[model samples]
Target: MTHPAVADLIARSNRLGADARNTNYAGGNTSAKATDTDPVTGQDVELLWVKGSGGDLGTLKEAGLAVLRLDRVRALTDVYPGVDREDEMVAAFDYCLHGKGGAAPSIDTAMHGLVDAPHVDHLHPDSGIALATAAEGEALTAECFGDRVVWVPWRRPGFQLGLDIAEIKEQHPQAIGCVLGGHGITAWGDTSEECENNSLEIIRTAEEFIAARTAGEHPFGPVRPGFAALPETERRARAAHLAPVIRGLASTDAPQVGHFTDADVVLDFTAREKLPALAELGTSCPDHFLRTKVKPMVVDLPADAPVEDVVTRLRELHETYRADYAAYYERHATADSPAMRGADPAIVLVPGVGMFSFGKNKQTARVAAEFYINAINVMRGAEAISTYAPIDESEKFRIEYWALEEAKLQRMPKPKALATRVGLVTGGASGIGKAIAERLAAEGACVVVADLNLDAAQEVADGLGGPDVAVAVRADVTDEDDVAALVDAAALAFGGVDLVVNNAGLSISKPLLETTTKDWDLQHDVMARGSFLVAREAARVMVAQDMGGNVVYISSKNSLFAGPNNLAYGSAKADQAHQVRLLAAELGANGIRVNGINPDAVVRGSGIFAGGWGAQRAATYGVPESELGAFYAQRTLLKKEVLPEHVAAAVVALTGPDLTQTTGLHIPVDSGVAAAFLR
Candidate 1:
């Protein structure tokens, strides 16, 4: 059970975090002072409950807070060294734990614990940051809030800054908060309610002051003629084409997932003539630039440019950005500095399209894009009221490569095998397709679930992990246009195509003489032609990405075995079986591995079995409908009934790291049917 004061602090944090205008995702912290019994001494002890390191205030819980003895926390003030060694104080905070160390304390813990108030709120809201980044920020802060909110000059966050703020708090008895110059805002009160109100007052007042003064000023200037966002369809089409190429470049050092945004603020900024100069100045807030990078690589071209020409230029731009970033690292890096993580830019801005942000996974990439937007809001506000002035480049370098920041990165959990992979699974709404989608998602790959049933696909995607791990797209595999669109949707949804599963198929059980032309065409077009179209379209994206990919075809045992009453389906399966070998030999130069799975009569929970094929097969085999699975199992040496999960497991193995050196291989998940084994 949570203490009432702690619960109140959490409620206030969530209220502020939920509103983007109040703060960005994971960009703020809050704290409350409370009393709790000391378990060891059996006496009451004043404790500080502050949001811990790497926690987002919006979703914070009791476990996400650090509980410390207020007396011990304040005692650190006596031993506080200078600002140069302030990072050591963070390590020293472990000794101040009240009981079991709840969570690792953030640097902001000092600011909260050292303050005289019982409640504190520190935020990076755009409105406050705008005022913080303005050239005349200190004076403007005074004009906006008078003595109620004071201004503190830019000082790197550490124990010394905490002391500085504490001194300011002591000096200004009437002040409710202080705006952090070139950073954000901090507020304090005797109660959680008062603290929250003070924080809100700072944000709202800053917003109003900026709004009144910059009412008619066009900070970003007018939109350039050809730089405005293209029509919806045109922009999406362009994005789909360029995303794979951009993702490939961004993943030069490590694989990354991507997120795209065309919000009005982004468009209004990207389309402006002054975008280059403003973007070159970089972001003002540390949280904003930490994810978005020091600056974005601006795509210098018309939105209406030819696709081939645009792709060529994008490659050139990526190369230049990498070189410039490398130079920047060389210019400021000390011997003790952590190695540069990557030279690739996290954010990519195209004049008429929008922004593309990349990270090791989907959520990270989305947050990066959102943070860049916050930076944009800060810039717009600052340029309108005063010249935008962020911290110096050297300061950004110090924070970016700080040993503590590197340690935080190192603390992240090891990625799963399929992390950063985008897999497109056809017929994914049910049966084997759904199983494969879910399995890939479990292994950390982003799955695009495609089926004729949009609602069913969405349900499967939602089950997998919603938009972050999976997305749903309605597609008819037999149609070339739909197959192309499906591949495009995957690239647009999660950067590029890293894996493709040709699982959308059907069967018609009939004697050779009784099989109609339509039956043959349906099976052949869907199983054979559909696989070809999907592979062909996805191959284009893979080659653009320059990243090796996997393509697994769900071939059948009937392809090699002579089964009576099966004509069209068997022939189509044979066509698919051969496709694996042919495509493997052709695509090997491009690092794409083509493989197939042969599963005999997967009747348990199979869509084909439920769609009347089971009855037809049972009648042909002279067995009861319910006994068909057993009959097929009995024919195998192991006598095991192959389920959808078995086939999905096979798909994961072929696409996983273990099978990197194996291609054009067909694995049979048919409970050991020696007759259909690959030679």
Candidate 2:
């Protein structure tokens, strides 16, 4: 059973968190005071239910709430330490738990517990933060709300800050909320509805204040000449080209997944002249700063610059960024400080192309980009009213390296086998390609599902969990330009291509005398040339990334078996098989492994079998079309069927860590087809 007050609190939190205008992801906490019968005491006690640490309020559930005895929480004042030791209080919160096995309490718990109200909300709404981070934020706060929302001085979030806000609230009995300098805002009320409305009032008022002050002023000054966003085709073309290079630079320390967005907010900001100056000052809100890092690297080159020139400049800029980051770490770090993480910029802004953000995985990368956009909004608002002044760099370093933040990072689950790897699978919409996409995604590799059928590819990508895990790309592997763009899309969607599955193929069966040039060319172009094209483009990305990669070709047993009336398909398969060995030998020096999977017969869920080839093969073997699979299975020594999943398993094995030292080898997924064995 749920308490009505807690239910109302959860509902309130969802409403606030759901709107990006109100709060960023997991950037706020809400709480309600409720009376519950303590199991042991059999008497009513006040329980405080607050959104727990790391839980996003938008998707919050009862399980995600930290329930604490309000009395016990308030009793903490007896053992309260000074501001210098406030970090220790976070651990102390564990003792105030209402019972065992609930979401762990968060740092903001103190803020909610100490406030003398049944409902409390602490949020980092961009609008509220815009006023909070302004140079004259206190004056602006008074001017905006006329004491309805008072101003609190800058104080890092902790037990002492909670006490500070409480005292201010007590002194100003009529105040409903207050804006924290260089931080965000807090609001409270006697009821959930009152609290929710108060929070909105503060947010909306701050926004209107900034808007009235600027009154349609250009946020980033006039756009520089030729710096506005490029045409849709050109912007994306540039993004695809530059994404791999940026991803490689961002992965200097550890492999990272990348996300590229040309959202109007990013383009509008990056296209303006103030981009460099504002980006250098970095983000204001702690959540925004934490995800996007201290600052972003702004590419000063024109978006229309020569591809080579852009690439060259990005490399140079990345090197400088790394050195500067290292220096920043050295200047602020103390003996007790955590070791420097990485010197790579999490966010990169290209003029016209938009923003590129990176993280150890896809969701993190995407959220980082979103956070920067929020930061940009905050900057625009703050600049409209007054100077945009965020916390000092030293403060950012403290928050970034805080012991509490480090602990949270340490608690994250271990990455799956293909953790930061990105895989591009041709023919990914159906058959073995679809199975391969699902399996690879399950193992933690972000997937690019490419196929000629755009709709089917999208279905598979959606089933694999949307853009966070998989994205669909329509491509013709036989076309060089399409193959190149497909590989680039993988880089743009993720960080780079770490695993390449050349599974797009077709088959044709005909007697040597009856086979036309059309049949031979079609089979060879799709099977042999397509494999070569996809592998070559993937290899280029892998080489630039400097990360060793794996390439698996889904060849066929027909490559080695001499079957009657199978000349064209057999020859194309042979060409694909040989290409695998050749690529293995060439790409080996670059740490790129090439391998092949040879399946004897995978009739079920096979695109080739579904497309007239199955009937032709059945007729050739004098078997009914319905029993074609059984007939092919019977000829194998093991007398078992080889399925699409079987071939998919082989693909996973080839790219998995177990086969790191094994390449240029074709693993047979056939049921003991002795005739198709590698000679």
Candidate 3:
């Protein structure tokens, strides 16, 4: 006979699921265990009634509950060969249900059975998930709960996970519930009301913690209000794609996880070029790890991107995720080690778009989805506190390759593009400029090489290998007309300019007292004034184009410190440093990004050193040309002379999509010069 509380429990479980569905496509799941002893048998029997598959909790019925005997499931562990046979597992599970062969048990029956409590309810609440994404998520949880919770690192769900939990219960008999890493939470008690209360408390605690932490901080800062919301059709499509995953991971009688779009925040953060750092923050909890992974795949969609394109892009990300997972595994795996299984994420968060979570049931999926939202907040918070530093590549590999960790990878769709769009360079002629120009072109952006030397620019353009791939332009950046011409040339050639590098400058050696006005003017003309000119012209084009742009100014260590006899060059470069900040503010309204690159003494044979400065400067320093190079090299933290190529890479980073919203930033390409200043 059915227990009296079973019906009430199912109703409450369905309500929780509905709540989840309305909130974030969370795929939340709930279950109620029958605690009443059989009057005739006079024996205790565990019966868990979990939500059925493919049903939404908001509109659930009695038929949705798949009833199963908990003890029977626990005993079947010894009978199965390895628990990989889903068909057999399903058959055996169906045998113990109330109907005896009607509907299949929820995929998370095993997971629910692991909890010793009579009733267990799990959900991927948005607040709870966000707190779990940090590198110190466990600490965050502790701070939120103060020893009322048990934390489990991410582990693949199903038999292995269930078995592990069962063992944990044996060790810690009084443990209440668990929060799974990269996944979601599990709350249990003797009654459905008790479980629900516990789950609610967890959500409330997490919400309060996040609110306290972000009390006075603005995620996107002061910006325009009343932005257009995402289209309804597009939102539904995204929701549909994520629903299944969320449902699959959840443990409810009906999938009730809600899904909402925070397009404004997502877009603003992405526009700021902070996605990579945000993604590195990982999920809110280990349970989320199974859905979203440690990091979410970021994509910048055009305002006009079609629904089909968005979906296609998502599929592409999944494919890339698989490849990345495989590569990561290969990098750290030992010969005798077990290989990683699955290569898909439990959750996929598209900034400025939406998020997707996958699971065998609604609760798990909702948990994953909620975790994704939490991740965004935590990432934003961590960024505010200090730059978020996720585990390094090696550590990521360790987690991705760990047998337990690998099990979280799921089946996913394909990836979209391998390269970004648009590029710019200041001194794109020889040495570093030429190398950077070539690198970006290879990655597939129509390149514009701006240089004071027209002939050198032409040569670099010629060597770039395609007629439409690169264009050489002449500009005395200090001259407004020339700077305007360079911008116009790039726009005419490639539709519009998206990147600019203020790289044309000369370094001269002269003691402060001995420096003449003529020497200062010459240095200031190209290094300081030229940078402003180029930035102004580029900003105009970028703003008009409406696609945003990047401006990277190549400054030098002389800007940071006074090298003996280099007074004029140093002063001019220092002016360029200040220029980056001014331009950042000026063009910020137009979505134009600006930054500066400061490189220490780079080796000769490059454009910056090509005009006989290498030999002359070397001799004046009282050392041979080759020995002078070594002398400068030995002075750095790395004891390696900064190369033109190193500076070129920095230029690419500043201009690339990888750093879309980053502006007014200064990156020291010196091995450690500025660092020494701090020391």
Best by TM-score: 1
**In order, what lDDT does every prediction score?**
0.92, 0.91, 0.62
Tens-place lDDT per residue, model 3, 5-119, is 6677766766676664222342556677665554458777667777665445566666767777767877777776674553355457766665352245655677676667777
Candidate 3 Cα deviation (angstroms), residue 439: 52
Per-model clash counts, in order, read 0, 0, 77
> Which candidate would rank higher by TM-score, 1 or 3?
1
lDDT of 2 at 665: 97
Q: Candidates ranked by TM-score, best first?
A: 1, 2, 3
lDDT of 2 by residue, 392-467 (tens): 9999998888889889989999998888899999999998999999999998999999999999999999999999
Worst 10 residues of 3 by lDDT: 247-256
Order of quality (lDDT): 1, 2, 3
What local lDDT score does residue 479 receive in model 1, on the 0 to 100 scale?
Answer: 90
Q: Against the true structure, what is each candidate's TM-score?
A: 0.99, 0.97, 0.42
Q: Is candidate 1 or candidate 2 better by TM-score?
A: 1
Off by over 4 Å in 3: 1-3, 21-26, 35-46, 53-56, 77-92, 166-175, 216-262, 280-679
